[model samples]
Target: MTSDSVLARKPSGQSDGFEHHLSPTAAQALRSNPLSAKATSVLSASYADSDIRDALGLLDKRGIQNTAETRRQLRLAVQKEVIDSNGDIIREFGHVAEQLKRIGLTIASLSQGCEEMKKHISAAHQETAPVLQEASDLMKQKDQVEAKQQLLKAFNAHFIMSEEDIATLTSTAEPVDDTFFAVLARAKKIHNDCEILLGTENQQLGLEIMEQISKSLNRAFQKLYRWIQREFKSLNLENPQISSSIRRALRVLAERPSLFQNCLDFFAEAREHILSDAFYTALTGTSVGGEEDASVKPIELVAHDPLRYVGDMLAWIHSATVSEREALEVLFISEGDEIAKGIQAGRDSEPWNVDGGNDFDGLKALNELVDRDVTGVARVLRQRIGQVIQSHEETIMAYKIANLLNFYRITFSKLLGEDSVLLESLTTLEESALNQFTTLMRDHVAGLQGESQLAPPDLAPPDFLQEGFKQLTAIMKTYETSLTSADSREADFEPILTEAFDPFMEGCENIAKHLEAPARTIFSINCLLAAKNILAPFDFTSTRLSKIQDTVDKHTSTLVEYQYSFFRANSGLQPLLQALAPLSDTKEDLLSIRSLDAFRPEVLIQASQTLDDFLPLALMDAMENLKNLQSSKMARKITEEAADRFCGDFERVEEKLVASDDIWEQEADEETLASSQPLKSLFPRTSGEITVLLS
Candidate 1:
């Protein structure tokens, strides 16, 4: 066969043997025959190219034939090589089979063990199911018990208080401190919370706790009350600063209204006695401790001077009142809000203690207490001042004392309320002084009225009236600087005006009654003008000034009328004016000049000569009549007005004369009229000429 056929065909049984002994990679290669065709082509190309002949020639030259036997031998050698490779592969397969058998046995043993473990696990599960269920039930019970324990702990903490807290709140051995306040607050809260419990279905526990807390709160309040009372007893109001403990105690005790008021009452009574004694010591310069400082003279030293004595006493009282109020101010104002809240809370809890819906007012309480404290001082002051007023003979001094009392009355009205006893005492004393002054003035006036000659010789203001006005001016000065409001000053000073000024004016009027009409008018004018001068500077005297002006105007009118009458009579027109008076208002011009002898032309010419003579001296003569009047300006004004009025009368007279003359002309013949002068020449002085002459 050719090398190609030999290469393409496998050795008959060798192929089966090689396939059986092949390693996996080698067996795969043989089954696929990846190089079979290439090997065949390579063999065919080698043979065609004489490569076999060349190989045989080389073999023959080596003394070897390239025959079929040699080829058979080469095939046998290849088969042997194949057999060796097969042997090695068979050994490797044997070793692999051995390893795989050992692995299979190990896997079978593992499977049997796994089956045994599965059966054991199922048996264990069946056995422990009841125990696991028991443990779960136990855990659930433990959680529930723990939750209930926590709830019980919370209940015990909230609803119950310890004995220590109670002791701190109610026991006297423990001092009032933060702990005590905290305990008291807790107790109060517990007491209030009992109302919540009472709203529940079970009311017994609520009632028990409520009663217990109520009793505890009452004891605690009583303790605070007594402590406050003790503190007040030792309080030194002379020192402006107070202790914090006392302030806190008072704030707390305000919750019990009855106790609070009682404490205040007690405090007021004690302060009243103390302040009364202190006032006496200050006045007398003799204190229980010892004599007062020599530099600070006693008020009694000035007793002879009633005004100073009263003023000093009032000053002392005022100083004491201010100090007392300042010392106690912190007690009320510092904790005002807290005290108010406490009182309102107390009002809710203890309704029976409330009084007519009147809430606690710190300022009002302070005023009432101060008023009570000054009660004794006010009484003694009133008595002493009343004595000074009664014994004093000087009317002006009495009036001054009244003014001093009035000033103090206003001062005390601001410190203590207007309705306070101290203010009322001052008011009464002021009224007493004023009454004494009024009585003295009235008596002085009555004595003046008894005088045989009341008016001055020159019709000037009398000495008594001048002296009264001097005193009144001093009083007006005092009232001007007073604390009275501007709106009320007029009203407040009215009584003083009536007392001080009116009596003197009335005395002047009464004295004027004895003089003649002219002197009487002058005297009245002098007195009214003097009073007006004194009162004009004060705003409060406007009403009185208006009245004085009216009276002066009335008297001035009288003077004008008197001057006008003088002009008429002096100018020789009185007779003619009398004649014309019956026909002055008549509209008819039928008057007969011959029937009225004064209206005759000769009579008219004679009157015109008198008028021309009087017109030159009219104002001078009128002013001479009023020379005794106090005010020259007033005299001049009256004179000028009278002269103007006389001019009007002259015009009327001139008109009447012209009319009468015309009527005569109408009745008489032309020859009879030629015998008489013209009416214009008859009345030579015209109203214009008279007006110019007067001016």
Candidate 2:
């Protein structure tokens, strides 16, 4: 290879070839740059001998110069270009080395300055370390002092009550206004918060504060109680508008139950005197001031009319009760929750205030107060009403008074509870009146049971029973309009029933004993039916009416049997029945006409004649027998049922006779049977014929 090709080729395992072709510096440059080596190889390959010869030939054909001079000049130009490039590279290296020397000087100066800064920082840290630690500790102490100051401020605000608050609570000079309530509430809160303080390690502050608050609250409550008592003393129940101050004071004072109840007791005592005087004035037209008002008439003006007198007295009491309740209602009803809390506080402080196992109830308290106020009025009412009931001899009037008492009893129960003195008085008076009525009835019934008074000839109910029923009807009418609850009306009226109707019925039975069997049954039926009809209009008397109906049914059955027996004997079937009754247990052949004397042809013919005679008038006579029965429907029903039963007996007799006829026909020859009547011809009346006649 030529020298250029040898320079372009990479040195392989043979170092001699690469060393012989390139100088040491050139070979080192080629080894350092593989890309430059590959480029030289490509240039060498392009300029091969054949390519150079082709180029020389083309140049000769083109008449251009192709000589060794041009080749030598190109080689010299390449050497000169490489020398210039090396020179440029040496200049660039010199510039870079100068710049690096300047950078090293700058770095040395920076290193010396850093050492000085490190010494200064170390001295500054050593000088300021204690100062920073002291500042941090001072800040921590400042925070702790601030936190404690804040805690003290909050503690004072929560647990302390001001002198102004204490004065508002305990000073009677200050009115019990909204401000007073606010201060009282704050005091209460302070009192409650002290409990938390008591739970801590130190309880001295809590105990001291609790004692101070307790004294203040007690004084406040005493003032309120006294104020309420004074207000009640000056209160006018005639005008039903109580002042708001009194109501608010009452609600607050409920916290101290002993004081609150003492105030109520005082108020009730005052009202009792006032109402008692008012009632006496209304009754006698005599005022407490001892001057009679011309415009006000005394209820005693109507004393001759016992019902109107008693009613007027009770009416006055009821009106007074309503007015009293209305006047005082706001004191108990308004702000009930606050009042309940106050009462609970009172219970917490004073456990003995809870009485009779009853919790504090606003409405119940109002009722009890009202009852106490009316205590005097109730005593007068009971006495007067008792006198009227004892002196009244009219049975109906006495029963009416009892009803009036019962009406007032229920009215007062609604107003003042069932246990109130007013209600108890009314109940006692009512019972007394009812007993008076019962005694009157018993006396009347006893008089009716004498020998001189007997069942009427017509077998109708006696006049006394009718009169008693009329009175009973009136009593029932009064009771029906009473205020008793619907579910309880039946039981409520039972005593009245026993006193009135039962005694009348007993009188009827006693009178009935004077009559014969059928008459007695009819009389008893008439009385029972009368009682049933009188009691039928009221739904509450269903049980009593049912008992009366049962008696009527029993009596009706007896009357039916009596009428039926009358028909049987009057129709001449009694003897025949007697004979048939014996034959019923005998053999079939024994039931023949020849077996009994009563069934003989002559006897049968006589019975047939009697039956024919009676069948035509059976129902009319039976109806006439029970004509005295008060219920015409019942009379007709009894007549029909009895007639029907009589027809049934006749049908049985006809059946027996017909059956005997068949035996007679079989037993007798035609001559004997023809001479003696056939059983059918003897008893010619069939049950159908009898039934038709009765109908």
Q: Please, what are the lDDT tens digits per residue for candidate 1 over residues 488-576?
A: 99988898888788888888888898889778898899999999999999999999899999999999899888888988899887887
> What TM-score quantifies how close candidate 2 is to the native fold?
0.75
Estimate the TM-score of every prediction: 0.77, 0.75
Candidate 2 wrongly placed segments (more than 4 Å) = 1-166, 199-202, 236-242, 293-297, 302-304, 350-359, 584-592, 595-624, 630-632, 667-688
Alpha carbon lDDT at 287, candidate 2: 90
lDDT of 2 by residue, 1-695 (tens): 23443345644453433434778898778767888777555444534478765744554565434356755675686689899999999999999999999999999999999999999999999999999999999999999999999999998787777788878888889877888878878877888888998999769989998999888877877767776887787887676566877777877788877787788889899999999999999998989889997877899985669889999999999999998887767667765567767777778867665452456678888899999999999999889889988888999899889889888898888888888989999989988998898899888877766646677778777788888888888989988888989989999899888877887788777778778887888888877877778899998899998888888889888987888888888989899888787565233654454657887778888988887887777777778877777778978887788878878888887877777777767877879876877778867888888888888
Residue pairs in clash, model 1: none
TM-score of predicted structure 1:
0.77
Off by over 4 Å in 1: 1-149, 201-203, 206-212, 238-240, 289-296, 302-304, 354-356, 582-591, 656-670, 679-683
Q: Which 10 successive residues of model 2 have the least lDDT summed? A: 1-10
The candidate that achieves the highest TM-score relative to the unseen native structure: 1
